[model samples]
Target chain A: MADTTTGQSLGAERTTEIQDAYMAMTRTKRMYGGIMLIVFIALMVSGFMLADSRNAGGFWDGILNIFNFPGEVLKEAGEKITLLPALMVKFFPSLVETINIAAASTLIGGLLAIVLSLLSTRGLARFPRLIGVFRRLMDILRAIPEIVVALVLIFVLGGGPVPAMIAIALHTAGALGKLFSEINENASLKPLEGLESTGATWSQRMLLGVVPQVAPNWLSYALLRFEINIRASAILGFVGSGGIGYDLKNAFSWGQGRYDEVAAIFILLFLTIVFFDQLSSHYRNKLVGKA
Target chain B: MTATAETLPITDLKQSATALIGRKRLLAFATPVVIAAYFVYLFFAFDIPGLVDRARMDNAAILVADSYSYKTHVTHDNRGGGLGFAIEGENKGTYPEGMLPEFVTRTGEDAVDIALKAGESATIEGSTLRYTRPDYGTVTVAVEGRDIILDTPDGTVPDWISASGARVNITGAGGRAVVTRARTEVYRYSMGWELFWFTLDSPFYGKSFGELAGLAFSGERVVADKSNLAAMVHDFWNNAMWRHKDVIWAIFETVLMAFLGTMGAALIALPLAFLAARNFTRLMSVRFAVRRFFDFVRGVDGLIWTIILSRAFGPGPMTGALAILITDSGSFGKMFSEALENVDDKQIEGVTSTGAKPLQRYRFGVIPQVTPVFLSQILYYLESNTRSATVIGAITGGGIGLLLTQAIITQKDWEEVSYYIVLVILMVIAMDWFSGWLRGKLIGRSE
Candidate 1:
């Protein structure tokens, strides 16, 4: 009876020690969390103040006038509602050019991405030693913003769809290459090993064995990239190239008198973006779901 | 199924199998053919053949060469009767009085001798400029009256030398010389960026790295009020030609735009996502309305948002940030709702069983369950928004993109353009690494 009582007391003492340690750890964690939250809030507040100071119009002032431009646009566009169709129709070719830029770049970039991803994949690379080189190349390609390339190319090639296409394509290749390589890593190596045993070349193995397994995922990613590239192409056009975005820019800068044209371009752009977003998402869901 | 197939005709199965294979094979062949045909159509549509005609090879050459090298102008005004030395013919890069490039020597009161690479020499005497090529002998150009005259060693201008009545231009491998009625100029091409560290006015300009290091620690003051290192840094930061301070500020503003936009979007979208999530909200109308709002904002796209916001906020990083915030809130709303819907109801039920209130239950159950997903999405967007911020900055007129556009617009600032490109790339890579690190720290690496 005496020994049992002593053992119970000892166990209680140990429990108390553990509870104290747990409380200390929890306190430290809470302190860290609080500190982090304070830091984050401070950063956000200061950043806002800095941005506000640098802005040509202060946030409070701008917020009140936020709806002014849109209201004017809508009113003017409403006044010329009958001309909306003609305006959209007139800009349709430019819209098509924008789509073409996106599509062609996606096609070209997707193809290049396939080759790059294949070459960079560990077990599937033709020259395994050069995988790092290919990866770094993709990183660089990805790091460069499309606008930089488009602007530079505009200097060389003059303003057109070609520069925009090339710029978007280069970016797409880098982006898709990274995603595709990730997909490649998850693929079963058994197929590759079997193909190797069958005396298949690297290209043949990749095409016959790996491509079959990853094609759907790759296609889905490419489709998503295509959606992104469409927006990118339009933006590039607005910057200097040729497309609906260029038309939008012209209409937008023309100000009040051309608000109808601006609204028409806006509608066209919005519709196209929505259409592609839905279509690509639908296809992507199917592809990923089937897989 | 095999038994039924066996009960059926074997030839019928074989025919069906053959047809299936044929169709698959045809699809395999047709896909590439269709792609090729589309490309061919695109070639015509994009005017690929005419692109060659439209392409300016000379401009390309100038861009490539000018990006890596700079030329020093040794100019003499015929009427003004004075020699001036400037880098790239820019007023800011003008050499101080009594100062000249190391390769230039004052031969007379109004003349100088320029020694170029490979035993090439040019001497300016009064209004005449004489350029001596190693093997081709000396070519002289003199501005006499309104008409400029060129005299080659052989008394005939070669293909490289283009002489008109009003001007004479002699292009040589070493340098280029042009004689006009108003002035005569000689351009000496050299490798590397000039005045990159310090402008022409700085006392520390043209100091070697070792010499700079020595001076930095030697207790010597380049300027009266500051130490050598401080003075050096001040000069480098305030470099007029490169504008390093402005460039750095631009980069900081870009990152600020991205950070503010991404975090602000996440903050705005969180509550809306709960309304849209099927598991969280009971009313269908609320969910539908929230979801449609998300779609509308997303479908309007960043370009449209940038345009509208710029009009309201004017040209600055604030506009770019707001544009990013508006566009990404839509994306975050959709993604967060999906994530919220995927959360396990058991956790919420467990919290409620503990006699927790609705807010307490959500805090304990829902937030924890979706925090990881929300964090991952926000971090991913943070990195991407940096790139978008650059593009938006271009449209909104702020950040490094604005600087880049301005530089490019100048057409002569290719070197600055190249510098900005490098810095932009580095900034992006740094952001990528940082976001990745933060993601790993917060949620652990998914891969």
Candidate 2:
């Protein structure tokens, strides 16, 4: 009976602490919480209405047909072959081409970004206004989807992989430029200052001091973006840009009984992503000297 | 590498000028070259016009009219030989020539049983056989040209008759010919157990991914090449009907959907974040729980959230929106909470100590301090979500990406496909600007 009473007292004490904390809250906080709650409720309700997941099968099936159409074309190609061997085949040729295009864009974009970062960072601290502009520009660049960019460009440049690659590369440059600049800015400033004190030129100082510090981070970021590029390539493939995404789309679009094949390709893609992640993590750890 | 004043100060100055000239040369030559090179490559990388010609010749026009005349191809998945009759010419699709013919085909074959019309040729073989005009539906000859226009029963439309029957040979542009035969092929097989992941990661990878794949799977195809893959790309670039347009639409719609959805996520996240911050809230426990919940939502990827939304709503803008909302909830929640927590408490005290009501105190003290950060984070996410929207669209089948995939597979029109790719990148840029403007308005109060 005494133990039970003690337990009850402990529970009571806990409640008292909670209430004390609650009571201790300044009126400013309660008011904020109440208002925030109301806003939260409204958003949640509206979002529920907007994103409700009750009727998505038809849409999914429709898209599945589009993305996996390449697979369907290949299968319907009437190449008599062993089932197991065919199942293990990788991306259709066109999809592979898409990946190539996306990769090319990434390379071109990253290369350009290196230069942009140099200019942006050099001007950023000296002119705080430039920082705002640079930052805003990047935000704007990233806000628009690549697909939309492709559509507009299609009207201008005609349809093909070149416009797609240009769009992908441009966005890549924008994104990478910002990330590289941040790394440079966050890098150790002591070396650059030391070089400056030695009467080293600005370019010399940046090359000898700044570049070394940020190189590892840049490489890490680059590697990460490569993975993203692959996914982006798949996206481009959907738009007839060329790649395996179309194959996946075809596989999904045909009929209901072929989900197993769709699942297989999906698995391969997932595995590819996982493998890249593992490889990247390995390199990142080695670079950082993680034990 | 060193120039000295002893020889001549003027000379030294000139030498230094030369060094500057070298640097300028490096910048002037490289900068424009790089940008110009990119533009050049974007303009004439491969035969962009050839893709159009090919598409025009052997049209695989989408089923925009619910029915199409498909010239069967005998080519393998690699545009090689398959079992079906390769349409000898552009007698495959349902489009009119010089007027968007209801059907058009390049080299694929048709096996339709048709009643011969007077002075018309039945597209059966490779040569346009001469026929005498007998009557409205009497005389007929099978012709094999780059295109074969057949007079079907439905107002003399172009239709392929080899549904599961005879095969046709194609001879044109050598590689552009498609084989026509009844096809029951399924996509090439991929190893299973690769996609069963339940973790969060945004790490990078090196080229050693193959070693890992080989390790993970027992029966791995080392060389997955042209046979199954190439045909897909070719179809996507060259096919018009539904291939290019559909994927483009998917991508376009995805961008719009994501932009709208991110807006919703931010609207929900901002004020709640302030409340969730202990420094800004009256209830500590509520703040902690709400913050944790937000974290949980943010913990999952937008793709997973897409699946969840698909379950909640039919696949459309709703599913895509839900996915964006769930992912952005966590992002906005954390950003807003941090902004709220960082606000100067002195201001809050200044307002409240004067016996001001809770609402007035919050309005005067807290909102202003955090609005800038809130707006900036929202903008950044809006930009980021544009890319993320691609994935959401993929999950829901409501974006240009859907058509994009089809185009890549069926038409192989790489040039047109490139345009879609460009569109997405541009959209990301536009979002970046709008968000920045919003941030400036809320905080910097600058132009």
Candidate 3:
């Protein structure tokens, strides 16, 4: 008991020293952090002040004249800069359109991924060469960018979210393929063994064994890919694909005093994303048995 | 009687054989039916011909001829060839009236030329003045028989026209002029045509950054590109694309964004993972609720979150970032919580049974056992987060990927467009290497 008391005292003293050092370091960091915060706030305020509606309109007019073709929507984008009321109307619709593009791309991409992903799994020991071929093939597919896929498809289909959808689907397939294989290769062998012992065919054993084991993994990968697809869809719109991104680009190029609206949208977007992310996480946790 | 009973078995066996034959007939009929059904499934599901055609199309781009013309010039005794074309209509529904043509041909010496349209606003003076393309040769036109033969200053027949009715030749310059149809394709929109035979052509994606900034803030009604406008789809994923811009930005805000988004939640649900663990917090009720909660959160998916956010923010980088944040957080949390449940708890008991404070015991006892696992988990999330950051960036208004998106969609500049892809690949590679190094340092460290 005496020895134990002494040990506790020594530990306490060590803790005090560590605490002191930590506090000193924290104070130094706090000073720099405070300065950064102040500077950031100042910059934002100044930018907001410069972003006047009238100024934006004037800027828009200036930009439109340089566009050469007044009838073209993209050329007229400069004209749209700076009108607060009009900005609000156009901004909202474009945002809505962007969401639609993302959502649809994710679902369709996710479905295609499920089929391709199975090929990547190593559970099919009987088809080792096929597994290697598919795994490598998936890697090559995933290696291409969403934009590249979008651009190539655009050459074929012309324009629109269809290209974006293709990009998302290919990406989803590669990503989910890799993920599905990892899950399959790591699944519990006991269940698979039990099925095999019952004289079940290899396919039957796989269905009874690997399918249930990787079900949660499939759900997780699909959800994650959906999130990525959302972002990709929005981006494709910037290239004249006609989504909210098109509106945003026009707003930026017309660069009158509409910076505040951009900031406002940024804030709104952040809040909404945070909310949904929180919600999805809740389900992912349940699947991993970690909630 | 006993002998007769035994003999009765032979008669019964004959009846049984008849029954067996009836069953075989039914099975034979069913087998073909099943085979037919299987083939029908394969045909509809595979769609082999359609897929083959699609693949063929993907490999080659189509070129359409809009409008074309040619010109040739004749000098003293030589012939030269030249040509020109107009690939698109100027808002006149694929055909414009009384419009002048531009030349695609190169200039050569001899010059008597005819514009294919036949009627010219300006009259050509005979003999002295001649027409020629900058790159192609010139053409001489004489009424087929009226001025067909001519003597030059050298007293030789002038070879200023080609043998073919559709071609022209100039003899003095010693060259030929011919006009052929030029092919062009108008993608979904008719902004411009890539020069045929030029594979490097791609969409232009940039203007001045300042110009883009103006369009974003300006009140004027900003119009969108055709590709975007046509994508106004009524679907969940389409909706999410617009919404997730916010999430993308959020993901880029901090490296810790991935961890906190994922594992912080895991920390909060530590008790649940512990309960689910057979050797740890084994209370059935606690385990059940924790498991259920994980399912509920993870079930919905990150895209849904992105969609929801896009609606709220209207669309942009923030939505994409926010989507990343929420997604990473939820996933990391669940992953880490599972690791916790799976951790060794021998030391945990020593501290807990001794009545050490809960926080103290956790810090000193449970932490050591799971330190490697936790560190590895964090590192992996960070690596994955970096890739995710790009995805978020693409949708959001900011990030290098935005430049790439612009290139692919607008300018059609394929060569430089590949630069963006290289950058993304480099980024992912770097992240993988960095995480792997960190993994070694953290998880592979000596106890």
Chain B TM-scores of the candidates: 0.97, 0.49, 0.46
Computed on C-alphas against the true complex, the DockQ of each candidate is 0.86, 0.10, 0.06
Best DockQ among the predictions, by candidate number: 1
Instruction: Give the CAPRI rating of model 3.
Output: incorrect
- Pick out the ten consecutive residues of candidate 2 chain B with the lowest summed lDDT: B195-204
User: Which pairs clash in model 1?
Assistant: none
lDDT of 3 by residue, B1-447 (tens): 999898899889988998898887787589568756754643453343454454535323321111111112211321322212222221111112332223212233322233322122111232222334333333323323223332134444344533443333343232233221111111112223222211111121223456645644555533344332122121212222122233233323323233333344344544545555545555778767766566554443443354344334433444444456555554555665667767666788788888889788878787777767766766776666655545444553334455555655543244334445655666656666777886776468442
Write down the RMSD of all candidates, one decimal each. 1.7, 21.5, 17.6
Ranking by DockQ: 1, 2, 3
How do the residues B92-170 of candidate 2 rate in per-residue lDDT, one tens digit apiece? Answer: 3212222211122234442222122222323323333222223323222232333333232334422222211233322
- Could you tell me the fnat of model 2? 0.19
> Could you tell me how far off, in angstroms, the CA of residue B156 lies in candidate 2 after the best superposition?
41
Better of 2 and 3 by TM-score: 2
lDDT of 1 by residue, B280-381 (tens): 899999999999999999999899999998999999989999999999999999999999988999999999999999999999989989998999889989
lDDT score for residue A166 of model 1:
95
